[model samples]
Target: MTTDLVAAVDIGGTKVAGALVDGTGDLLHRVQGPTRARESAENVLRAVTDVVTQLTEHELWHRVVAVGIGSAGPVDARNGTVSPVNIPAWREFPLVEGVRKTTGALPINLVGDGAAIAAGEHWTGAARGRSNALCMVVSTGVGGGLIVDGRLRPGPTGNAGHIGHISVDFNGDLCPCGGRGCVERIASGTNIARYALAAGWRPAEPDGDVTAAGVAAAAAAGDPIALAAYDRSARALAAGIAATATLVEIETVVVGGGVSQAGEVLFGPLRRALGEFATLPFVRNLEVAPAQLGTDAGLVGAAAACWSDPDTFLIRGEAGN
Candidate 1:
């Protein structure tokens, strides 16, 4: 039995992960390295290069037909570049060129991490069988992607489905993205914890570990402020999701990330808020579901990008590259 595989790279603020993914959505070999995002841009690229080197050295490397890279946005797939928000060192980084130089210029599919997640979910998770859907990650930051007409629409720049920066509250607090009332400004895990702390939601433990998880613990213990913080985040997320559904006609929204793991504490309010915002006739049937894939969604989605549309695969030396 011949097993076809693809080399997958997932680049984030904290770490750079790589894997050999088989056609069945299985990761055969994996390696990772710290991103050291605060370091120089060359240092960040070194970490990514290390991941590619490890993957190519595997004996099964020959079975890998292509490479797929999912990086923090905003990514320009058309120009084969990326400028991740968290990694300040990488401003319009030539990611595709770096990967090509390391891997002998194999075909590469570059996409924003959000688009990768949507492709993964569409292939094997919550959005499976749904032609039009939205997939999101609400962790240290919020990000999302879209599926349209039975295909992942990464858009020209590969950052099309970025829902986090969308202004849900025009007159609200200023966001890091220079927008007021962005969904991420209120709904991200970091913001959730910040809101809880600013509102006097102290931790039960005396260590002062005021994390989103800590806030979740407080909410679980019936802390009113913590619960209200989550409610506020949920409301903002609902507005963003509803706006996406209203504009693009998505039928489902699959939410993943650390915040979503809070389960009902977040979803209960998010669903209720969505009911209030997604009131349009076309968007009335939009449904929300939990992402079935965990952290591995990025890896699976990277490979799925290649499998999802082989014809449009971006070769290393192609015009875009």
Candidate 2:
């Protein structure tokens, strides 16, 4: 007897990744290709097709039951379209229809990359076993997804728990999303590095590295400017997480992405800031932890979405069964 599997695709500005995932959340086969983000829309679709075609060549492809996609937002899962900010060439691209032509009649499901991370974490990572949680990616830009009542909530357009764009500072910096004081503007890895540089912080080794990882090293080494940068980022993130918890009532917040790898440098200040902002009785005890799935979260989460209610699947261009 063949084991059931899901063909999972993770589409991002940098790469298009595809994998065959089993019911137990294990990756059986995988393939990846660079995303020609600056090229034409057809080129991007070709990248996705190439990944899917590689998956189809796997011997276990016969057991694949469905295809699930986790693409960078802003995505309209209801309409099977995607408009990732980093992929400027794909404005309102019909990703579902494009991928469907490669997969034949297999059912397809779509969700924001942030939501897919949440689904992956809730299924087997840090948010696992939690009935309610918020999962975030704090990389070049901040993004998030919600898990309410033990189920992944991608919302109507698959962008529900986008905590990054929420205004945490009413009069703060302007965000690319056209919102002032958005969490992404203040707390993303890029912003953290920018803050450090603007504050006169220089790298210890003169490697000319001004990324968040460099800031983390400086913070760990007791550089005041670097420490202040991380502190500000942490505070912004805390405010966003607190607001989400207060409104929706979550038990935990699982953080992923490059900046989250800072370990104590980020989490220490984050917990302190959360204590200051989340003073409410109900939200005071919210737990925050690092994600365990690492880079596989997107692929695993896409498969997890397929294993969910078939009624929630996005078949062809229509939502639900």
Candidate 3:
């Protein structure tokens, strides 16, 4: 199969981002659209169709063979239904089929946004050439993906990697999943600010506005409350990584997301906590590093998913796969 191009769409909580990527992982074109709450799935489909058709109609996307989509959590890839919490209208919605109908005849392979990041890391990011790695996105909510034994482990119904809900503390905090003390509840960028407020560390939030970025800025200015918030976040995040490493035997933990922009405030203490918590020595060397893909990871990883066979894409079939 001579190479051409593939269209990658990343359907996030607040937005739908799409890019036309080539075989070398270079994006040819990119565009985005808004994601409104309570907006019917049909409307979402219309918005996406408009952007994709606009791109494909331009002849720039002529060679595009397949479409790879990365959507929000609770997505059913086999059934091609999307039931994301942030977007209520998508409950059991047929996103892939809708787009397929609108985009002419093309094969659409779908996976969660977390899984797309994992595929991107394995294809060209931090976890490149490594097997059994944990790919985490610590943004508004903590999300995760895995490349175990060189295979994509998208749960029974393609919702396997909802790692944010993993309980880090039994009595920590109540998560949206009805679980108490989930990693996301305590460690996610959104939660970091919440936890800070509960501890009387008020930076700002007249309308619940203190974001992870705001917290980072305050901490940079040497605010004790912000420092405490980041510390707790690092502790919770590290504990989760340790447990996951033990369970999956992942060689590395590649961290991404906007909160990860806090840099050492999040990772430095994270490494220390991981070292303190990990019981096994082999798992200790699980180098925890920041993700390098930036905002383009989603699209590139979505495009990378089209190259399902690692051997064919990475040129090391015998090594693993």
Candidate 4:
């Protein structure tokens, strides 16, 4: 059987990862380079170029027909530009142009990282078989994507489901994004640890790191402050999830990322809080499931973007089937 392949690129603050992926979602060859996000824009672009260069040298490179990119957004998919927040060097960077220049005239598909997660989930992860769903990543930050009526809805700019910046607490703390009490302000791992610390929680041993994972450990050990922090974060997440569901009526919410590794520590409270906020009859049956794709969602989804079938076209911003 002849194998068709696509070049997949996942670009973020920390790294630019690339792969040659077959139609079945298998990564035939992979390469990566540090993003060096604070450096000059040219330096960061060089890193991405390095990853692509390596992929082009792979034995399977000749079989690749198209290219797909899942990037940390504020992406202008309509114009093939990007302005990722964490990567300060890039502002309206011609990412598609850069990739095209390096890899030739192959069709290039670009989408925000959150939308890629949604695409991956809808294709093969926890959101599989769901007609409508939300896929979220709650780690250093909270990012999300929407699946509406069995299709991914990446708005014109490719950032339709940016649930992180949505205000959940009007009178609460100001977020770095200049929003008041955004969901990311409370539910992100950074804030989870910050909340615990502000509430007088401290590591038992000297010189111990203070992090959300540490807080989860303390919460598991019955620390009141730590448990309270998780509860607060969960409540904020529930509010955001409920709001999204009420607006679009998603059937399930698939969550991934580092903070979600807390397992029941986060989900137990999140489930309880969701029950309180998602009170509408239509959203009462929303299911919250752990994502199964782990760290590979971006890569798999990038490859998935190359296909223009009726189901996948939704993610590529074509009219729904």
Best-fitting candidate, scored by TM-score: 1
TM-score for each prediction? 0.95, 0.94, 0.90, 0.92
When 1 and 3 are scored with TM-score, the better candidate is: 1
Total backbone collisions for each predicted model: 0, 0, 0, 1
Could you give candidate 1's per-residue lDDT for residues 121-184 as a string of tens digits?
9989999999999999999888989999989998888887899999999999998767899999
lDDT preference between candidates 1 and 2, better one: 2
Ranking by lDDT: 2, 1, 4, 3
Which candidate model has the greater lDDT, 2 or 4?
Answer: 2
Model 3, range 232-319, lDDT digits (tens) per residue?
8888888888888888788889999999999988887788888887769778888888998988888888888766733234442332
Question: How high a TM-score does candidate 1 get?
Answer: 0.95
lDDT of 2 by residue, 181-223 (tens): 9999999898999999998999977776799999999899899
User: lDDT for model 3, on a 0 to 1 scale?
Assistant: 0.80
RMSD per prediction, one decimal? 2.9, 3.0, 4.3, 3.6
Local accuracy of candidate 4 as per-residue lDDT tens digits, 1-321: 126787899887778899898767777888888989999988988899899999989888887777888898788988889988778778899988988889986778888888888888887889889999999988877888888888888787888788888899999899877789999999999999999999899998877769999999999889999999999999999999999999998889999988898999999999999999999899998899999988888887777655633333343333223
RMSD of 4: 3.6
